[model samples]
Target: MTTRDTTVAVFRPDDERLRDAVELVESLGATPVADPMLEVRETGASPRTDADYTVLTSKTGAEIARETGWEPGETTVCAIGSATAGALREQGYDVDLVPDEFSSTGMVELLAERVDGARVEVARSDHGSQVLLDGLEAAGAYVHETVLYELVRPEGAGGSAELAASGDLDAACFTSSLTVANFLAAAEERGIRADAVAGLADAVVGVIGEPTRETAESEGIAVDVVPENADFDELACAVVERAAPTYHD
Candidate 1:
């Protein structure tokens, strides 16, 4: 198999994210199928005010906080992963804590041991998880959650479903659990869920972390690769590694 024979599906919503995935796929000499599964729309909700600490779970959350002019003055900032931390730092917020595992459970463990009787604000998407709120509450922290954006499946996601059913995808890259879920949902809507799952099972499925891998597996799609460091570049490399025999031989 050659570069022309290797086709990868990049399922991230935002243009910047899609571009990054495309570039990574190109760098690996593979063709990228850009079909955004979800789109991010601002919710127009203001960030919580006067909190002792602020939590950001994704890059979208950090971007929303920056665009909304939310200041973290003297407040401890916590991020779920390095990407989120980098996004927060770009917005002039110093990330005080980043969990080693880069997941809600990881953040919970870190905060449960350190944060007590503190007011914490969580900024995330409308479909964000309740794990942080529940975990923080159980750890004795008052958590104020605000939805900064909404992750909705785009109307033209059927292309992805078709691609998945075509069985032409050599690898599929998923950055978040929502991406995996939305892709499966799109396939389900098109009555191609079984074919989509089979196609993904036949290809190299690269996930950013364990959570995304779990989500993909839960949808009956076999995940072949998960990067050690939850990053897109690493995920892309993992895909290339998994597909190497097809292209290299």
Candidate 2:
């Protein structure tokens, strides 16, 4: 592996998770460009209790649901990923279903056969993909979505984009499609969208999963790393390894 110094850009929310991500990058001997692209705005809403199935797509949604007194009394609870499941369990909600793939497509696939003709309530951020709702509807289920929160780009969040434009970004870990969109928007705001994209082409770009990868690719970003499991830690590790491939004898 190359021992050369690496500077990686991370776009996690400005919270504990961001700190953890920066710590992970440091442990891998890379300089971290800590920029928060997503900010959570709670909508003060909760899942309806009448649904036959309840879906939570993110950790923020689960946390907000718990905060808003959403008790899943007899409702078959589903989570999009392990982190969301863990959040539900932490709040004393029993998670009954977790898709193997950990994405909207995965959730729809997991419930397609079983949720036919059933009432499925999806409670999540406003940035959720229409694919989930359309897939569930096509599978013959009645789907209702409640926006638990909204994910917005934090103000003045494109410093990393400028760094990337200047050719200082060695890698970027994009955890979601919205983050990719937000990053580009910030870059565009700074009038450096083209330069930033060009710079990113010269560096290793890693996305959390297929959905994120698709979004990045659709925007002309070349994705170099996608971990088998769609989680932040796994994504981060894979990207770091790509930035400076693992050494061997």
Candidate 3:
């Protein structure tokens, strides 16, 4: 196997996950640009009540729910993604279900068989799409949602612009539509024009799935990985395989 050094920019936020990514990059002998283009803010709380089921959509949701002392025993918690599931588990809740696809549709499919007219409460970001709740309600399940947090676009994508301008970035991974949109916005805020951004067309743009890929494609960035599933491992492997010439060529 050929090992080539890659410089990658992570446009999410300066969180524990960012620290983990930094460590991973160092382990691989690759450079990581910590450009925090998205800031997560806890903005709402779910009142303590008897809920039959709880849907944890993101780590932010899990954190906020944990902070607000959401009890796990009374409610069967279903995490939308594995990362969220891990977060919930760390917070002492046994995650009953995790979607294989890691999207609203996938969650809906799994939930359709599990919930037996249970009252479901969704803990999620304020600005996230309502597809999960809508799907659950359409399937004859009692569902309600509480906004746990909001994702604010950062002032600018400082690190991404610097890495891209120096032509050092081999790839950038976007996990969500918000990440892709805010990363580009941050690049523009740091004075990167359309032509300059487009010039990195050869750079591998790794996206989690179709929605994120669509957002990146709309911004004119070349997507090298639109994984069959939206799992984090799949995304990471896809990025490594596609960005390295030895793996793809």
Candidate 4:
């Protein structure tokens, strides 16, 4: 039996997407741990009136807005990527723009062509990166942001912290800055060493976007791979390949 000590810790909510990552890990014969660091909560309402554009960056955003309800009719919906666009479309929102690249900067670039001086409301995580908001505002879009959710880790990560403390994890996947921050907070709560987490600099530390990569680097974690896009599937495949190439089924 080729028992690999590699483990890929996914700090995402226990959504279908988490399951997808778990399946990917199993296909590679590696252990998959569900170590969610953030909880997504859809809050508030359409804070702006007659928003010419609505920007959704994650599936949680789409679901929150859909559940909260919005005025019917065509509102140019811009998404960070295809996956988010699909999520918006499935929820009955007409997706007008889905950038080729996946990031707030990407979405801002995509919106430049269709909006300028137009009121735009962004449904985003409570702790959001300023790139998108700054870029869009610079591009002359009337940007308003609504904190749709917060990402928090589960009560305790079981004994996963001990594994990372001992450098047992071959890799860890951080999909968002919140996930990265929350994961570190959880580790500290469990008395894990900073070096043990940073050791992934030599191993596989997967990030979903530039912002996430930047955060990981700042935390002294070696980021071995960042997908071409921010889609979870793209990230999952990249992490699996980087950490356990031979384990791939």
Each prediction's TM-score versus the true structure: 0.94, 0.96, 0.86, 0.90
- Lowest lDDT sum, 10 consecutive residues, model 4, at 40-49
**lDDT-best of 2 and 4:** 2
Candidate 1 vs candidate 2, TM-score winner:
2
User: How many backbone clashes can be found in candidate 2?
Assistant: 0
Q: Best candidate, TM-score-wise?
A: 2
| Candidates' RMSD to native | 1.7, 1.6, 3.0, 2.2
Model 1 clash pairs? none
Alpha carbon lDDT of residue 119, candidate 2? 95
Best by lDDT: 2
| lDDT score at residue 216, model 2, on the 0-100 scale | 97
Error of 3 at 84 (Å): 1.4
lDDT of 2 at 193: 99
On lDDT, who's better, 2 or 3?
2
Model 4 TM: 0.90
| TM-score-superior candidate, 2 or 4 | 2
Window of ten residues with lowest summed lDDT in model 2: 240-249
Clashing pairs in 3: 157-186
lDDT of each: 0.84, 0.90, 0.73, 0.74
Better candidate by TM-score, 1 or 3: 1
What TM-score should be assigned to candidate 2?
0.96
Q: lDDT tens digits, residues 57-139, model 1? A: 99888988989988888778899999999998888888999999888888999999677999988889887777888999999
In lDDT terms, how accurate is model 3? 0.73
